[model samples]
Target: MNKTINDPNSPHSIAAEFGVLGSMLIEEEIAGEVIQLLNKSCFLVPANQVIFEVMTHLYDNNKPLDVIVLQEELRSRGLLDQIGGSEYLFSLVEGVPSAGNVEHYAHVVRDKSILRQLMAAADEIGTLTRSGNMDTEELLDRAEQLIYEVTQKKAVNEPEHIYNLLLNIFADIENSNHSPGLSSGFPDLDNLLSGLKGSTLNILAARPSMGKTSFALNIADNVGVRQSEGVLIFSIEMSKDQLARNMVCARARISPHKLSYGVDEKEYKILTTDASVFAQAPIFIDDTPAISIREIQAKARRFKTKNDIKLIIIDYLQLIEGPKEKKENRQQEISFISRKLKEVARELDIPIIALSQLNRSVDARDDHRPRMSDLRESGALEQDADSILFLYRDEYYNKETTEPGISEVIVAKNRTGPTGSVKLRFIKEYMKFMGISYQKPT
Candidate 1:
């Protein structure tokens, strides 16, 4: 009987009595409810572990927590001591309850901290157990519900439903006014795609020197100048100044090579004045090399906060890095990056224009027209993007061909509209693309 009663593992004894006492203490109306709440929410982990987690979170944020706010929080959990309470909560040290009685309460809290640790350990047993056991759809729904509940609590007085309705109305009004109806950079293309929309991903792909960058820049410049909204261009391949110079030379109808190397006296004056004017345009560029998607999101958010950033341009998608993870192959990395970029666009509620490079298979083909299959490294790019435009300049393929200066803007995948090709005038010297005159392509 003593063995059964005194044994640490015994179901009955002082330790067992303490465990029951501890659980009762946890259940009582006092600050112990915070510990109970934490256990319930995060799972009963060790009290010290929970403390460590909360402290680390606070430390990383570098802010002093308000104890009054914390006390009120405990009160909301129905944990505050009753005026004529019979139960004694562990004594309070400073403002927080003592951690001394946690061992006794372990069983009542179910050693919730230990239970959580066990669950986490069980999670690592195998991939099959971790993933296959859980119904992902149900889990996702539960998670989303929890998030909504928490966020609603935080924004209790914000009138979210009404604000959402107002936001929808504002969005409709803005889109209606800014709608680029049946107007593409090319007349034939306009007949097909109309124009890009808000909150869309448009990928432009090509082999090098196929006017992909030039085409994307042209579109961005047009959107900025014509729409009168600021456009952010993240250039992993080129510097901001270099892109700006290209834009100035293109807009001023001067040769990029001549402007960069040495301009004639008359062209020099025109280029200088044009450069100054273009500098004042609402075009912002960040030329950070090999930037991760997270950095892009942070910078884009800051830009939106500071200025009304309407459009975002990423010069080539493959250059972006995925979240820090060891991937089996480059394909997976590219896939991760593509998905993240799409997510970023959705989060920011802005259109994303990402440039891409086609595989050599496109060059091997007799038609040399870029296809969805030719998207380099990852098919996820095709899956994530709302639209994919392939830039095919015939002049690069066959110099002797009759169609020398024409480029095809092939809409391979467009979620919003029809798929077809738009023809534009590709001026190689100026590194610019212009909509072919409405009259005819002479």
Candidate 2:
């Protein structure tokens, strides 16, 4: 059992830190076990941290880790004198009674590291709140974001045995009546993707005017209204009112221009009836512009707790801001953003469908279909995503094409199943995509 301490210095466990280091030194083979629970940052004392770093370095480089090898490593780095030479290293070994409690000692070190992180976050929050730059909600949001980042950083990185995984696999096989994961509301597409799996990131890419937003909203409405599952959408490009209006158009079969103008009482009744359904739907939208990926994750977590959100959708990925200090360039920044989005999906245990814009090079090609390479600024988005989908409508490029009302959903990549395209009818007036249903022969 883990005990909580309230004193300012209670977070530090000096003896435990030494116990972990000494345990690793005694049985170098167990270095892998110690690394699993504790890293160099877990140690509170400066000298202990230095010693831990030397051991971690040796382990990572495939070098033998005994007191002799450790001493040479510290000497080569000129940290031997700084960390009190060979005598201090031997004292660490003498302190540990046995290697059996190394994991417990490492847990103590890790717990203290997390507590210190919490304290720092609280201090930062206090400083920011006193500055009076943000309102109450923004202040709370920022504080939660900081604290969540710390919690996410110390996630248990471990490998699970196959026996533990086989249990869930067998259960899923037995319960094969309903869809696995969440359904996408399309039979063929659902078969292609067994629905969107949890802890997966899916990319939905298209060029401008290809109805990416409309498609995303369609899926959101299906999950929120049809399945009664909570869904959260981050609309960085459009306002909440615009999204509501789109819902009305799609549900009521009314045009955008007609929505703005007051129609007759009969039309008004139709629009209101359609709008009422959306009002009751469990679809929440946030229209924060240029929002960072970290902010999106934080907001998603809050909604998941409060509203039981099961799915997250981000309309267009490039609009999201990346980390400020660590970004090397736009490509690297995008790489960082894409990587973080994938991490958010796994950490939150939900599927994230992030809309993306394909590079304009697709326009210059003879075949304007989007490929994996077309994922804008960062190829990392393509690499990180579990599935990649492309939306193509031939009518958009040539008004007089043979295929006028058809839209193709190209399943460019599927991590778990077969890849193929599903054809659907596109109604531009109402901004809706419908699956093609075949009639039985009379």
Candidate 3:
């Protein structure tokens, strides 16, 4: 049903709708541009929407855009009489004189559609608020997601030529010399992986005592403290305080076990100094145990918008909960979690390093080294990840090993670069992983 011009209550632009439709009828090329700019929902009146839909069908089928073809298409679809027949179609072409301003009129239609969507969102939010059915955090996340959808509605991806793509690739190659993606803080790993390229999901898996968390924390510390970049860590298994303590001990080269008992004067002085530097670093930690994937998405987006965080680290993947409906099938749930994490990484255009638990089968091996198959629960972790790295330490499984304090980061899968291993010096007492060449000054 079409509203009269006198009805000013709802948002609508009948003149703009006529302008767009008339322009498309005047010039066939305008139809393509208008279709890309405005969908059927942008039409205020039901008749105009039906008209646009039929017009789109005709245009897509390579049929001429004219009164007779549109009428025939609508008639074939049994929508001609319902939308006021051939006379209404004639009026659309006669209403406007030119097709040059079709894009401008399409923007008007798009603006009106956005207004209606916002109004609908506001009403729904009001109802949700009045019901008080959801928790505060969850409700807030839902509301933000609704608004974010509206803001993102105008973003459309159109097909491009390879010539254009090559230009972008060349530009990136030139820019990479000065400004590469955020570095992992390890020169060897960064060299192999090209500095943890953005919009990529990198999985770091390890057995129980392989120091994966410590390795991740060391990267976080390096990025935050040394490089002065923003970092977000979803520490599911450990509290923020515990992570902070670990970072301090790692940076100061002090034993966490000794600090637990008591910090001596020298250790206390170094701790205070290191703590001050850490306090200024742009590292944010969320210790939400058993966090749902949706919660991670919401918080990650929020942090990305507010803090402009360059990196996101999930302490371990197994602790994350998938959709509640898939509780009975654990593998399906894990697959869902990993896929969503990858989507979140791409959506935010940042690297997400999600630590994962290796299967117990890793212990059955003589060497006890982790592998891609050992990514516990879901094989999707291997499929979805752009890079898969396994943490291996000889001292963890051997008592008197020659490679004590040395850990190997086996790059099992690297999508964009060569697959190889990088060695790092692991200081167990301080819970720190540093480059193999890192040495204390005499």
Top of the candidates by lDDT = 3
lDDT for model 3, on a 0 to 1 scale?
0.85
- Per-prediction TM-score to the true structure, in the order listed: 0.60, 0.67, 0.72
Q: How many clashes show up per model?
A: 6, 0, 0
Write down the lDDT that model 2 would get.
Answer: 0.83
Q: Can you write out model 3's per-residue Cα lDDT over 174-227, one digit (the tens) per residue?
A: 876743667777888888898887899999999888899999999898889988
lDDT of each: 0.62, 0.83, 0.85
Ranking by lDDT: 3, 2, 1
Alpha carbon lDDT at 125, candidate 3: 74
Which stretches in model 1 have alpha-carbon errors above 4 Å? Answer: 1-191, 438-442
After superposition, the stretches of candidate 3 with alpha carbons farther than 4 Å from their true spots are 1-143, 149-154, 440-442
Q: What is the lDDT of residue 100 in candidate 2?
A: 91
lDDT for each residue of candidate 1 in 63-86, tens digit (9 for 90 to 100)? 343334323433554544431111
Give every collision pair in model 2: none
